[model samples]
Target chain A: MKLVRIFFKAVTMELSRRMAYKADFIIRCFILVINSIISPIFALILYTTTPGIPGWKFEEFILFQGTLIFVFGFTHAFFWQLLSFTIYEVRKGSFDRFLLLPYKPLSYLTASSIETDGFSEMFTGIIIIWWAFKKLGLSIFSANFILYIYLVFLALVFHYSLNIITASFSLIFIRSWALMDILSSLVIFAKYPASIYHIGMVFFFTFIFPIAISAHYPVQALLSAVSYKLILFLTLSVSLFFYLSISLWNFGLKKYKSAGG
Target chain B: MKKYRELTKIGAKIALAYKFDFIVSIFTVPISIIVFYFLWKTIYAYSGLDVIRGYTFEEMVNYFIMSMVIALLGWSNIERVVEYDVLYGEMVLRLLSPVTYLASLFYTEMGLKAMSLLVEATPIFLIGIVFFKAKVFSILNLILYAIAVLFSIGLVFLISFLIGLSSFWLKRISGISRSKKLFLSFLGGGFVPLTFFPKIFQQISEWLPFQYIRYVPINIYLGKYSTFLALEMIGRQIIWIILLYIIAKILWNRAIRKFCGVGV
Candidate 1:
């Protein structure tokens, strides 16, 4: 309870700081939302030129893009600053301050910072998902809302895990930002359908990196494409990723020798 | 000119020191190409048509690969650096430097761009030609393309310089810079060729200077526009260059005045 309270307080503090600059925050939100709007436009162009990507129609694909934008925007809002600060502090010797804190360093690192611009993603996502559902002749608020929300939660964890794993590399390297950027950029593949890529890529993103769970798989589950086996697979895979991520961070912590110490 | 030459050499060496960043920048070409290759492959395979928007499968792939190559060549860390400089009062160093700030920046960008061409762009350019087997252009077309490539790089730098200059007043430019990048990339046809866009969109893109930044040069190499159209393309590019150069100079003057007024 105390730990949760710490996180809550950090989030509130971050939000108030962001809200301190009203115009700046509003413009950032607008820009982020506009940037996200481009992906759907990309989808629109492809669909117009072609019918769509094989089995997927343009409308159906909007949900996939929407899910992706929402997932990435949310993950990035929190962890972009988190990992960036982790690296900055590590480099500048400010990390010692965190070490001095009574609470765990990992918790403090994860919970303290938030970006309000990310909320724009959720709003845009809702708009896209609703419009896409309407165009596809499906109910917007189906009984699967809870299931979809739960799957989104799983994807969120997966995203957080991926971020931490890349961030852990900064412990040893003088600069790992490029590596993190490359890894994050590779998620562009997951925005499209799984069937479009080769068989090997499908397996890699699904079972190995499991980026598809963030958007593609969740959309599939929402579309009733799988049986109970999907849930089982998701639970197992999410657990495995979360475990590996934590292990990686601990390994980095062990390797860390404070820069300015 | 002597000072600019010295700064350029220093900039190249400084850029080369970060070898990992160079490698990643080069790697982005293949990674992006692969993803888009799969995407268009699906699009083409599903459409069951030979030509959509006048781009064959090979041409479409080659176009994107070329755009990525061009974009990689033009990449500069100037905007982010400028934002930080304004934020933390690092602009004072530039202000105090004996060399003119914009001249120093231009020299550094040229050095880095030259390094990218030698170390990153040329190898990838050759590999793309061999691997993608795009339409072979005539020697004269290649010469024309070479001219446009220089101007395109200049255009990108000027646009970024203008955005950086805005940091003087805005103070925090993350949002403005982000918006600028999106506009540049989209209108520059970094993702898809402008020809593939809806007619209205293509028109709008043509009106903007961004299309002249990449689309004009890449399409020239692809042998899409020729004769009068090619001349017109290059003509518009040079015109926009002059226009933006004037705009950038005006803004630089005002921004510097504002900086002095505020005394950062």
Candidate 2:
């Protein structure tokens, strides 16, 4: 309870600091809205040019894209600072302050930075998802929909694990920012159906990287036919990725030079 | 002229010192290429051998590969410098220099990126041409394509300049800069061909300036337009460049005045 209170206090302080920059914050929110609007325009172009991209209809693609934007907004809202934690802290030699704190470094790092712009994208994403669902003729209240939501939670864990793994690399290399950018761009692939690729590559995405699980599998579970084995594989992959990321993070922390100390 | 050349040489040397960054950026090209390859490949598979948006599967792949290369070559890191100067108050020192800060920074950064482009493109070009059996243009076409590419680079530089200059007003412009880059990639046909866009979008994109940087050059290289049409397109690009350049200058003057007034 005390730890939770401390985390909340840190989060509140960060939010207040973010709020102080009102103009910049509002501009960023507008940028996010523009970004959300533009993504669907591209997807619309694709859908119009080609009938359907293998295993995904026009509405299905919209759902995938909308869900992706939605989930990304959620992650960015809560943990956007994780993306820059290493670079900011290392440059300021403030990372040592995190180490000095009683709480886990990851939790502290996450709590200390919040981007309110993400809330704008998250709001837009929810609207897009609802529109996509209506277009696709999916039953929103079905028992199967609940199972799909569960899988989405699993996928979020897997997605967060990939980010944690990559961010952990910051301890060894200061230039991990560029690598993170590349990785984030690669995540765009998950916004489409995995069946578009070869089965081997799909397997690679699901197991090796887990991006397929991020959007492809859960959406498939919700709207298309999927096997129990695939679900089990996805759950196992999420657990394995989370474990590896945590272990790698611990390993990287030991090698951290921490700018000053 | 001599001073600019010397500064360019120095910039190239500094870029060479960061060999790892140069190498890692090369990896970025293949990732984009593979993603588009799969995307268009999927489209082709579903549609069968019919041409969509005037591009066959193979042709679309070639177009995107070239677009990716051109976009990489035309890439600008001016925002980093802008953010640095704005946050650290280094703009004051830069303002004191005899040279126009934007022009000097532009030439130096462009020269550095041009040199890095050669290093990055050599391997990709070789593999793309020799292994992939990608189509090559005639010698004259290649030269014309090079001119178009230089124009595209100028257009991108101006855009980046505007984004960077906005930092004078906004404390943090990275999000805005990123959003602009993303917008360009989608709307400018960096991710997919602009030809595939709806007619309304296609017409709109033609006027947007972003399309001139990526789509116009690549389309010209792909022989999508005749020589007369290509020249007209290049003229349009030049117009956008001049317009953006003027806007950037006005913004710079006002932003600096504000900065001086506030003493931030």
lDDT scores in order: 0.79, 0.76
* lDDT (tens digit, per residue) of candidate 1 on B1-264: 788899899889977886677777666667777788888898888789899888888888888877877877877657777878877777788888998777888898888888888878887777677766655567777777878888888888888888788767666667777777667878788888888788998877767888888888888887888757877888888899889989988887787776753333
Tens-digit lDDT track for model 2 on B1-264? 877887688778887876666667566667667776777787788788668878877778777777777766877778868877887888888888777888789768866776767887666666567645567665555666778888888888888888888777777776777687777677778877887777897888766888887787777877878888888888988888899999988898888777752323
lDDT of 2 at B200: 92
- State model 1's lDDT: 0.79
Error of model 2, residue A154, in angstroms: 1.0
lDDT of 2 by residue, A90-187 (tens): 65667777789888888767665566767888898888889988887888788668777888788778767777777787766755556666667777
TM-scores of all candidate predictions against the true structure: 0.93, 0.91
In each prediction, how many residue pairs overlap at the backbone (N, C-alpha, C within less than 3 A)?
0, 0
Q: What is model 1's DockQ versus the real complex?
A: 0.64
* Top-lDDT candidate index: 1
Distance from true position, residue B79, model 1, in Å?
3.3
Clash list (residue pairs), candidate 2 = none
